[model samples]
Target: MSYEADVCIVGAGPGGALLGYLLAKKGLSVILLEQNAELGKAFRGEHLNEEGEAVLKSHNLFEAIEAHGLLRMEKLEYFNNGQLFKTIVADPTVGHLGIHVPQAHLLKVILDKTHQFPHFTCMLNTKVTQLATDESGRYVGVVASKDGISIEIASQLIIGADGRYSTIRKQSHIDMAKRKHGFDLLWAKIPAPKGWEPAIKMALIGDKQLSLFAQTNGFIQIGWNIEQGSFSELRKQAFTPFIQQLTKAFPDLTEIVVQHIQSWRDFVLLDVFSSHCDSWGTEGLVLLGDAVHTMTPTGAFGLNSALKDADCLASLLSKETIAQFDVQVFQQMREPDINEVLTKQIEKEQTFAANFLETAS
Candidate 1:
């Protein structure tokens, strides 16, 4: 099978989907490919900050997403040794400290908006196997596989929004600098207790961070930081004593935690790392989101930064013809801000333990 478009986007996450929508809305033919048959297949970066909210609203898509469902965290509460010590409320003007937007809800609205444009095409369950280049080695399209069939897609420009371990970025031979932040995360979600308020509850356990984020559908997301590469050894230990620490920090969740997280198998372990590419583009291809700059989940900046990337790139693309497009300009415009966020994440992680200690004093 063969397809062609002005823009070819790999991945249907927030950044890729939004870029496709924005480009297609401007009347540029776009083809978006996703290896997954469905959106939100796994636990992903779902927290939306003010920057992300601004991008969604600017594009007039936030309301549609909100209609689908989202949760607004009203405040950030810090706890140490099972007692609340510091509380930071959202400014009245801002309305929320953070927003929990399920990726499914976000992608549906953007993809649905793109569907209104006749030039937009979405290929789910389609995986790009390799890049197609001309005599000059300029990327012209992608060779992908859908099910068992080979598919070829020709495009004027290709985008690598496939994420941190992006195939497009890999095939393009982009060099990425990776940094491990000395910790990994164990994530689990349990039913929110009756009348639970929407907020971010954080606890410190022996220099590690434990976070509870309230979700839209009466659920509480748990993120527990463990030593980097220590899950295997940690698992060898008894599970009961480990989980008891959670209840020790939040006694109110004792009953639910017992019911939901009885064994280690219930949690999904994430290898925490951040990465950056000095160059985000080469020839006819460009990378955005985690493909260009991957962030640790500390400040919930990854998703928002990706949204900003899509927005800025779309704006730039709108101003030029395909022949005149310059991916370097996009990198220049976005690099500084992204680098600042990456640095802030490191500082935040380093200072996390100090915050709890100061409160105790």
Candidate 2:
């Protein structure tokens, strides 16, 4: 079977969903595809920096998500050797240090709004298998599978927003130049302690790193950096002491971590890798978000960058410049900004301990 639309976006993530909403709002026919049946995911970066907030507000999508429930971190505290040393309170003018909105809520709100436009369609449980190209070998759309049945979706433009491991990008043979951060992440979430104030916490864990993010759902998200590819060996060495180290830094979390995180299985491992595509667009196909450049979660830039890309790409598409689509226009506009953020993230990861100690002193 075959379907057609003005724009076919693979992956109903933040980027794809928002782009779909934007194009559909402008009366363009769009189809957003999601391999997952549900919007909720266990491990998505939920941090909403000021830039992402501004994008949502600009699109008039912020209030609805905020009303749904979001957590505004009141402070960003730094601790050294298990001792609180500095606190940066959220400034009203600059916006809270950061806000936490579940990916589920953001995507849901965006899709709900998109549905109001008759031209927008979201296909859940559909996975793109390959790209559909014309005789001239120019890109057109995708060939996907739904419930074990083949379905072809042709569009004027095909966008790869499928995420860091983007299928569309892989199918298109885009070269993603990858950079390793030399570290991995272990993430775990448990219920917030009683009367726990909402804040972001950073702690130095015996020369390593630990961070805690307060979530709107009454959970405290805990993330710690480990040496790259060390999970197996570390788990075999007894995970209790490592977790104890975390609890030791934040005594308040002693009982909570003990109760909720007992084994290595309790923590999800995130391999830290960042990449940028050699080229972002070709003919009728373009890429956005992690599909174009994968950002590590260091400075909370991943989500916001994706949002920015979608916003800019929507504008480019609205002008219907595919025939004259020059990847340079989008790259020239976005690369510098993304480079700045990525540089900051790198600096933060490298000198975080020194900066924390210096600031504390």
Q: Which numbered prediction scores highest in TM-score against the true structure? A: 1
lDDT score for candidate 1 against the true structure: 0.93
Residue 303, candidate 2: how far off, in angstroms?
0.5
- Residues 178-285 of candidate 1: C-alpha lDDT, one tens digit per residue: 999999999999999999999999998888999999999999999999999999999999999999899999999999999999898999999999999988989899
What TM-score do all the candidates reach, one by one? 0.98, 0.97
Instruction: Go through the candidates in order and give each one's C-alpha lDDT.
Output: 0.93, 0.87
Best by lDDT: 1
Residue-level lDDT of model 2, residues 1-361, one tens digit each, is 9999988999888989999999898778999999998876759898999999999999999999998889898999887666788889988897698999999899889888976788788988999988988999889889999877899998988999999999988898889999999889999999998888789999887566799999987899998998888888998987788788888889888888899999999999999998887689787888889998999989789999999999998888764665566767888889989888888889888897784667443
Where does model 2 exceed 4 Å of error? 319-323, 356-361
